[model samples]
Target: MMASVNEYYQQMEKTGIPKRFTHVLPPNEIEYKNWLVGQNGLPPVEEWRDRMYAETVKLLKTMQDGCKDQWDDDYWTAVIESKGVESPTNGHSLFSRCS
Candidate 1:
């Protein structure tokens, strides 16, 4: 079963990955999120949430796989922060942009 969003958030916190890291999610993830949003109500909403959690977990794992030895908190932190957050020009919530 896929983990809950809270579980994923907790895992990210434990690993020193900030929630802000979502701001820098790769293009595929962004596309997935957009597609998921477009399919709203076609399936149960919980299913959407679960799929998103799975995708995010997959991305994180791929990132960790690229590390030389262990997960490098500093490197990930710098990469995430360097991407920074863009303001929502259309007045949508900042969180919605990540969604």
Candidate 2:
């Protein structure tokens, strides 16, 4: 687990060893307007749909692979779907369904 790794790294640091993670992607946000229909909210946009999906999937699978032992399938799915993707339609969020 990451926490255990971090702990080990911390102990090593006391003796002057560096600790590192192989894969760490910074975070970004995706707007949900496109997923929603033209109601009271903003109109949908086409550009974001494919890109958002691709990016979301890539980030998710990468994280899942990296943290395979740290998280169960359901937990990893929850982390990605909740934080990364957006669904403006259906009056719900992609992360919600992922959970």
Candidate 3:
């Protein structure tokens, strides 16, 4: 029989691999998490995938929120000016230089 999720999480933590590091380690850890959360009769591969996706979304949202207030127009203008590069004109956008 498979171990319960709590048991599996405890085992991983005791082994010095936090559950979050499953994103970077071998597939076995992720498989184990999936296996633990699955129904007794069938595996919940979709659920595991959704969980990972949700983690990524959460991380992105956190990063975005952290930077949201730190990057206003004046900030970009100062950054460009400091680098001796001309800022974009009123009619053009920053991305225009990339084209």
TM-score of each: 0.24, 0.24, 0.24
What lDDT would candidate 2 get against the real structure?
A: 0.49
Instruction: TM-score for candidate 3, please give it.
Output: 0.24
Give a tens-digit lDDT track for model 1, residues 2-77.
Answer: 4677786787799788898854555455466667867884533344345546655665587743533333334444
Worst 10 residues of 3 by lDDT: 90-99
Task: Order the candidate numbers by TM-score, best to worst.
Answer: 3, 2, 1
Q: How close is each model in CA RMSD to the real structure?
A: 15.6, 15.4, 14.7
Model 1 TM-score, 2 decimals: 0.24
Error of 1 at 42 (Å): 17
lDDT score of residue 80 within candidate 1: 41
The candidate scoring highest on lDDT is: 3
What's the true lDDT of residue 60 in model 3?
53
Badly placed stretches (over 4 Å) of model 3 are 1-29, 47-99
Task: Flag clash pairs in model 3.
Answer: none
Candidate order by lDDT, highest to lowest?
Answer: 3, 1, 2
